[model samples]
Target: MTCAFILGAAVWPGGRPSPTLERRSLHAAQMYHAGRVSRIMCCGGLGRNAPSEADVMVEILTGAGVPRTAILIEDRSTTTRENIAFGLERLGMSDEIVLVTDGYHAPRARAIARSLGIRCTSDSPAHKARPRTILRESGAWLKFLWQRMRGI
Candidate 1:
């Protein structure tokens, strides 16, 4: 019973899932419907002036025909590290996990999980995003690489 881990993005002020989040959530839902995974784990935390990202993702997945019981939310991780760490713990460090996120974010997401000693597979929906998203993710990659260089 592999669980699909849907990494959350920002939520709009009105609690809408951000584009990245919606994309990932939809992908997770599709995987569930296709019998690729047994459950979906939505991961994210609250941001300023917005609801928890995980909550938004759970809502989106549920609305996309995924049953509520099939979705689990970890709404307390504001950063990728927190998300991976807390999610791994909540899921009992299961080896059967498929990390879902945008392409640009998958490397770092997978690295973080591996750093924590959790082995799992990954799946990123086709990458199409605003220029801002590309830039932000690029910076994230640099930061992750720099931290690794520094052994942080």
Candidate 2:
């Protein structure tokens, strides 16, 4: 990865962190404080017309002791590509970012982000999600693949 960006998303059906997503945020925070990246660009938009994912993740991070100033929220994105693109333009982060999401999602997220000329890597943070949730994520991953292939 050239740099780092913490991808945020809506809470899972179960709730905040959703186990797996928590792992992603924790990893992103660790990466940020470990001197691996200069900034943490939180990505995601509002789902269900609720508070934005970026907002939700930032609160979680802050509760974990990450300062507000250290987080950047990209609130207009509704998809992986939109996440990277909106984040890059809105936050003006570095060329490279370590994409954060469920393990099943990292590959496709990185693929889409890099396709947009952004240097990116993967950090799967689904430590909190249960096996069933993971299976759901995997299904979503396949759907993502189909949509990308179909130019959707």
- Kindly list the per-residue Cα lDDT of model 1 for residues 52-152, writing each as its tens digit: 99888878888899999988888889888888788877888644989998887888889888887778788988876689878988898888889888988
lDDT of 2 by residue, 1-152 (tens): 34456666556643455454466677777777777765677787877645677776777778777777777788888887788888889756535667777765677788777667676677765455568767877787788779778977
Off by over 4 Å in 1: 129-131
RMSD of each: 1.6, 3.3
Worst 10 residues of 1 by lDDT: 86-95
Which ten residues in a row are the worst by lDDT in model 2? 12-21
Full-model lDDT for every candidate: 0.85, 0.70
lDDT for model 1 comes to 0.85
